[model samples]
Target: MTRKTVRIAMNGVTGRMGYRQHLVRSILALREQGGLDLGDGTVLWPEPVLVGRREHALRELADRHGLDQANVSTDVDAVLADDSIDIFFDAAMTSTREDLLKKAIAAGKHIYTEKPSATSLDGALELARLANAAGIKHGVVQDKIFLPGLLKLKRLIDGGFFGRILSVRGEFGYWVFEGDWQEAQRPSWNYRAEDGGGIVVDMFPHWEYVLHELFGRVKSVTALAATHIPQRWDEQSKPYDATADDAAYGIFELESGAIAQINSSWAVRVNRDELVEFQVDGTEGSAVAGLRNCRAQHRSATPKPVWNPDIPVTESFREQWQEVPDNGEFDNGFKVQWELFLRHVALDEPYHWDLLAGARGVQLAELGLKSSAEGRRYDVPELTL
Candidate 1:
């Protein structure tokens, strides 16, 4: 038996997302059971060559993880040039993604980068082409597909529980902290359009999975987007202009003749969760999954509509649903995808979450942007895998 180990390099591991995605998230996942739980070689762990601009941050990470001189550095090129490093993982901000990913592919390392893979449609397509041409494994972080709630829904759909699925309605939104007085926070880059930001691009990948998983591919989409909030304060108490779309309403048409409507927002009042809430209807049955519960209604007892708002209603339609239990522990969404990447590289396994899927997502955002700009419907391009 041959000894198995795949050396890996991380690019942009210093920024907020980089720190979480690369250092805390990916590093925790690479271990057997996370943090110092290095078992007796049960799972294949990749040695990391951390590359970032911040020396102090890198040094701190190295010290915290005991990486020291073994596999840590400030030079990205050095890490890419090393023959031992088999995988290149990128959790860099969206603006810096394309060039770095292309560089890694040129260096002949398998790649896993965060979405939207690139800010533009052509950029993502080109990256996919490069990865395909080079014959290196490439995957984008599509954490939503692996979500436990959605996974259960996938099983139900595959089991033919929802026959000839018709439409999907998704409501996903909540107010995110703008690093105001509380200074508690979300990534500021997300609210800034120039830095490759916005709710449409940031969250469409999640909708892509649910829509593609249940109905099929998207043929076209029409959207309306807005910049509801204009100013927000950063950590320094300096006000920054918000340029990205804060809220988006989109209608999707799947290739399989099904339709979908999605509402993604940053200014919505939280009545339910900000999570991806779904209501899927079909010929045989219907399923509804959200933060609090997952419910189903068969064709036998489909709604006929009772029209008395003042009347005493016994069976509340909303109260009929029951909570979906936690299928997996509360791991960061980043960590779930990170582990899959490790398995993909070390085990030589097939990872379904690829760059093409990410490109489709980019296309969706692009269409949303177009619809918002042109003030009309935009036909989504099919996934060019």
Candidate 2:
């Protein structure tokens, strides 16, 4: 039995992801519960040092989280120079990520970052390369794969429940109003192009887990994006110019000959919170997974259809895709990945979701952007060794 106490230096503790990853999830799951249960006596406990931009803000954050043993400060230099901290976590916005990460690597620390590794692909590749050379463990927050519902989908696939997967269709979208006037569903930066925010960069990291793990590596992609709502009202009744794409439609060609069609948008009105789901079709059967349900249909399934053109009709087969509740913790998204990462760090076990996995996500986003700009499909490189 090995008990490892890892010292963590949290970067970007002032922002949304920072507060959640650094304060809430990390503190609750790792510091309090001693990481996720790996079915043995391996405990990953984090002794965290909180860092932020402002003194008052950082101190308050540290106090609120009851991080008594934490060294809370606004000094980035001080945090980087500390020898005791084992890992440096960056959940900061994409714009400041490159410079901050470069500094962290120089300090000889393992790294954990949020999606869209850097604002650009070159920076992301270089960051991964540097970490590899430094001989330190690095990973990004790829929380989607561990989602219990999605995990069920993964289990079914690995269990051969979906025989010979043919294609994956992903529907991810929701309606977000400007929180300024009403309650803004998403932050203002999410809609601003200057903030390095968009459907492609923010959401593709999640897709990276789905597309690569389930269907196979994406061979190529072509995409189109649009800013459906150009002007939105802010909290102060000010009109804010929205430049980022509110909707994106794309097609991914996978090496396994399984094509994926994905859509991400902020303009769609749906009765789901952060609507994220996918339907996987196979030769012998098909399956659909959502936040609430995961179900499969075998060869014994029957086909149902409604033949009316003007009325709201429900197909009898639609009810076949039902909900399944897992017998484990089903809390926030960050918490799921938080415990998984700590378990990996604590035990030094084989964690397949490494830094390279995160970089592959950046590659997809980069190529998607290129495809939109060039008006042609681009090839996705083979990454896993």
Candidate 3:
């Protein structure tokens, strides 16, 4: 089989998500597995060029991964200028992504990036326009849809298990420790408004795609945002005003006429089996899916509970639901998307999750924040390049 190396200039490998998920689990894992077979008589090998501001951190990461230090560079411009680099992948801070992507597009490289592609809808739209104008293949990270639980949920949808879907309820969050006693689980910038950080800006993209891809396009949204913790310590044990919203409660109206209510918060403690969970109820069946597992209850199997104020309930409601079995081995969601994008770049395959789709996600986040600010429902408009 003929082998081809796809050089990926990956920026922001120092951040937690960038380092762990994208770099380690996805790109490096692909390298470890001896590359992806492209179905034709060819195998696509991924060669990662780590790019970021901190040269030492990049070098250290490269060393840890047994990668050549010569592939690590602090100069993104030089990396972009390299004609050999086929794709430019960004997992950098959201505020800085648009400009970097613009450069990569200008340098004639394919694009793949993490979402909130920009801080605003217009900026995101601009990137989409430029990439389309340049005729460069592009994609955004929509990792949640490839998750095991969500995949199971999608399977049920395809099998008509939900029969006339009715509504979806999602709960996502965990208490991020303030940097005072224990170092914060997340970066301090996540709580700062100026740094393009907030739960709405960060998570609404995930929700937008999940709702749009699985159910139907979100037609309208009514949301309320809050700064549950007004004060928090930074990385250096210095306290700062936590300006960004830590929690967001949203009610979304889907085009399919199903209502989705989601509660996203960083101040809440975990009570469920997973960090994030969605309970979808329909006419024929209902399913509750977490990050890894999914459980469903058919309308015929659903237990009826009598409302009794004075008497104790006897039915075991949780026990009635059947667990969704994994018929296939689930790989890391990030890695799966990387392989798909690589295939798209190498084989001219159809990939719908382009920069336009990412722009829609940014649009949702922008409108969600606006809805919260105005204390009113906002209609989601269709976006075009």
**lDDT value for model 1:** 0.77
- lDDT of the candidates, in the order given: 0.77, 0.76, 0.94
Number of backbone-clashing residue pairs for each candidate, in the order shown: 1, 3, 0
Best by the TM-score measure: 3
Q: What is candidate 1's lDDT per residue for 1-385, written digit by digit as tens?
A: 2335667787777777777765666675556353222234544655677887777777788788777566667778888888888989887778888988988999999998878899898999899999999988888877766656666677678889888988988888877766666562566777899998898888776677668766788888888988888887766777899898888898988998888998998887777643667888899988877643466677876656678989787776765544445565645556767776766665556787888888888888888888889999878766674
- The TM-scores, one per candidate, come to 0.88, 0.89, 0.99
Stretches > 4 Å off in candidate 3: none
Model 2 TM-score, all chains together: 0.89
The C-alpha local distance difference test score for the whole of candidate 2 amounts to 0.76
Model 2, range 187-206, lDDT digits (tens) per residue? 67777889887888887767
- RMSD (Cα, Å) for all candidates, in order, is 3.3, 2.8, 0.8
Question: Of the candidates shown, which would achieve the greatest lDDT relative to the real structure?
Answer: 3
Q: Residue pairs in steric clash, candidate 1? A: 220-380
Q: Which prediction has more favorable TM-score, 1 or 2?
A: 2
